[model samples]
Target: MKTLIDYLNAIPVEARDSFAARCGTSFDYLRQVGYGNRACTERLAINLERESGRELVCELLCPDADWAFIRAAPPPGRRRGRARNRTT
Candidate 1:
């Protein structure tokens, strides 16, 4: 079976850290689930969706997420604004 890391790694590298950060998680968390040390959580999944600008978890777990809308990545050549929104 393909592992979570397998899926995570498939995500674009630029999307990785933000995905984890938005998920209110860290790469360690990804490693845990990816390495089979933890179970997936709704919060984590939701955060990832928010981070990646994709609608995977919501489509798979919560029907309400389908309409939740995807957040667009900043246009190419533009970096995200200050990292003030981060919580860690």
Candidate 2:
């Protein structure tokens, strides 16, 4: 089976750099993880999932983590900007 590191390394380098920047992780660190020099942390996984909308945290950190509990947690605050109030 393909490992997570393999999957991460498969991404284009430019996009990986951008994703690392958005997740507040250094590109070097990401490369290290991809190379299997360092293990991925749950916190980092969570941050990545938050920024990229990928559920890698559950897939990597907590393979058995219940999706219902994950969904029950409070949603992240507005990542782009202030919420827009709309009237219909």
Candidate 3:
């Protein structure tokens, strides 16, 4: 199986740093999540894609993805609570 390190290595170094900066986080934090040491939250993934201008979804679905982390991607948005109760 492919490792987290392998995936991270695949991303260009400049892209990584640019993403880290756009996320308002340090490179270490990015590494932590990218390398699977930390959880990859939806916000983080969104930030990564938005910031890095890369397709994180593609990366997550890659054959080399860490299943645990890949599964952690947030579920699709659903209407709930008052929003669902309202009859627009």
Which candidate leads the pack in lDDT? 2
Global lDDT of each model?
0.62, 0.66, 0.60
Candidate with more favorable, higher lDDT: 1 or 3: 1
What digit string (tens of lDDT, one per residue) describes model 2 on residues 6-83? 556776877887878886788789767657687667666677667655634445643555656666676676345577
RMSD of each: 12.7, 7.3, 7.5
Off by over 4 Å in 3: 1-18, 58-88
Sorted by lDDT (best first), the order is: 2, 1, 3
| Residue-wise C-alpha lDDT for candidate 3, range 1-88, written one tens digit per residue | 3343454577688777765777677778877876667776666665665654553553562335464664565557843345544476
List runs of model 1 lying over 4 Å from the truth.
1-3, 11-15, 58-88
Candidate number with greatest TM-score: 2
For candidate 1, the per-residue lDDT at 32 reads 84
Clashes of 1: 0
Task: Count the clashes in each prediction.
Answer: 0, 0, 0
Q: Model 2 misses residue 73 by how many Å?
A: 4.9
